[model samples]
Target: MEQLMEYLLHYVWQHRLYGLAPLATTDGQAVDVIDPGVHNLVNSGPDFFNAKVKINGMLWAGNVEVHERSSDWFRHHHDTDAAYNNVVLHIVSAADAEVRTADGKQLPQMVLSVPDYLQHNYQALIDEETYPPCYRIIPHVPPLTVHNWLSRLTVERLESKTDRVQQYLHRTGGDWERAFFITLARNFGFGTNAQAFEQWALTIDPQQIGKHRDDVFQVEAFFMGQAGLLDDTLVKAERRDSYYMRLKSEYAFLQHKFGLTPISHAQWRFGRLRPQNFPHVRLSQLARLYSERRADFSLLTETSSLDALRALFRIGVTNYWRTHYAFGEESRESDKTLQTSSLNLLLINTVSPLLFACGRQRMDEDLAERAFALLEQLPAERNYITRCWERAGIKAAHAADSQALIQLRQHYCDGKDCLRCQFGALYLKQGRS
Candidate 1:
């Protein structure tokens, strides 16, 4: 029950979801919450920062700490930490014990009662079997409200992706080109092999590959060999894949020359994947792009049109991959390349985020605007999530809307964290009028 209280208290306090009545601290001093303060997601000092409140007709500005019970303050040892010294108000569902600062000054404590409507409405939303908890209210929500909320969710989703790119830049020691490659590689693997591709990218040095960029075969040898695809154990053992042996031999020489070690073969997942999505095909296409200077970040940012970006990522695998999905196994000869849908996905997931991250780091507003334009230019993704939202009366008009829906499904819906979601807030406010 305490855990449940802790979960709901934070959002309730932030949203001011309490009865409209005069309030006072446990010691009978008047208190009025002005701003509940910013919810601290990343830091350790306080649950909220820079809160505003009026205590006994005096305006007090400080941080706020909240919990299921007031005794949790000492249980968490905030009283001994100097960081808690600035916390002017301790809000809890129950004032179980007196809290103090490191200097032993008793802190003002306020008990916030849970509104019965919120608890009942939240429970109903959770109990509902619909894809979106607030689907019933969705149709009633003003179109403008839906539009504004989706716009915010879209930017939030993009910003989250941007944070990932920034971390890559940090890990790559501020090398934008290397960071872009890793980001593209992960997206190239798209569904199943994304993690394996990222691990594979981290092992290979981008600068070392640049030296042999003139030769596509050398690049293939480096990429395939480093991915552990050339290993004898992974190939279908019945047929001796000569092309595999050839690349293995070449990679042997290159591996010796560059002092490189391949990632373990066990890392790659193959079951249930299509022929085109196999590591060999995708990695070969990547090798082609890298060797041909097509995947260069500087050139990509200079591209201005959606068609131009499509052409940039529309790379085909080398001749060997064109004939086979795996080493040693030959299939019908066909032109194997990124299809239109695949190209769109690459643009939506990889290209836009890269542009946004580059724009922010370089302080170029054009680049940031380009990121938004790219999403706006693309069609909505045809997936279960979009279909689900469409069933809920919220069809995605573009990639931005689809991405926002996906974000909502993943972050808010999956966690049942409706208290922090706007849609949930509206559903809870029903019948209050």
Candidate 2:
């Protein structure tokens, strides 16, 4: 019973469902409910009522208590405050009292409940583990509504990403190109090495880094060294021949010349990961990309298609990286090339979103649309978050659903802001209205 009540409260609160219409008065009076505002006593207390509420053809006002039950109002003490005087309805789940407003007026209300099937369905979803029960069972759901919702949710998701991007942009002093490079490096670092990549960017000045454009290998070496991938303690070979050694020496030269700070010796985690995903290789790829496209984000801004994004992100490693994962590996490197899907993930998750955000800031809808299309073309990402939504009877046919699923997981489920969700109250009411 407690769990059910808690769920109901969460559902209502998350969805802002409290004070909704069809409220029942304490005396079981049947009336049409009107604009149910949040009940706050401070402002309304000075008057004859603690709150002002209305019912069908009646403008009710008084200090009366509302609750899941009439007994709870007394339990909570509405009689103490004149602020509750305007409560025209003694709304409750079960009515059993002769409650009155401070103005000495009796309030009317209505008992509201929803269908049983919807309730059971909602409960099953809230408690299930399966993904896409509706998609798997019901031949189809309405695509038009789903599509529209997806589009709306996807843009909302982008706005959130843009918010973070804007913060980074401000930190970078609105240098979109430098900001983008740092973003790309962070994304390339994947989940584990993001800190190291960011740290690497901080040590190297973006303007000076552009000078080594002719030799992509030297550029990659500098980035790799700055990522702490060229530590002499970790490498087995001497500093002149091995990849790590070469990078270390080059980095030392650059640091001396430009007075650049050394990247911290912090581990850019590679454990439990495929060698291809090692921070060294990622940094190399990033440096190669920057070296090849000195114009950086300006070039990316001009790009409009998935093909162009793929081309931009596909910058290959130098010959040395083609045969090595780390500095000492001489054996045939199996994971020599970056996967196209991985590139798409970086572009969609990192580049495209930032581009869209910048586009919106510049009032360039066309650029934003191009970024949107790139994201849409990619296959939806499957994760625990999406699985939960699917279990909840929500189906995704595209990236919009994926975006909503992420937001749902981040801001709603994980944050426990169920009452703040659009589907929460209705979903709860459907179960036990």
Number of backbone collisions per candidate:
1, 28
lDDT of 2 by residue, 1-433 (tens): 4335434533332233555555444454445433344543246332123344455456654433335555555665665556666555554455666665556655464343424554465565556444332334223435565566567768878888888678778888887876777777777777787777776775667767778877887787677666666666666555335555667788888768777765766656767988888776677677677777733778788776777678777765677777877665664754355688787778767777877988899999888987788777877777787776666566565565687778766766554444444454333344344
Model 1, residue 186: distance off in Å is: 0.9
For every candidate in turn, the CA RMSD to the true structure comes to 1.6, 6.7
Each candidate: what lDDT? Answer: 0.88, 0.63
Expressed as tens digits, the lDDT of each residue in 338-402 for candidate 1 is 99999998888888999989898889999998998889889999899899889888999999889
TM for every model, in the order presented, reads: 0.96, 0.71
| Candidate 2, residue 235: how far the Cα is off, in Å | 2.5
Candidate achieving the largest TM-score = 1
Name the regions of candidate 2 deviating beyond 4 angstroms: 1-33, 37-52, 55-125, 131-140, 237-242, 333-335, 382-401, 409-433
> How far is 353's C-alpha from truth in model 2 (Å)?
0.2
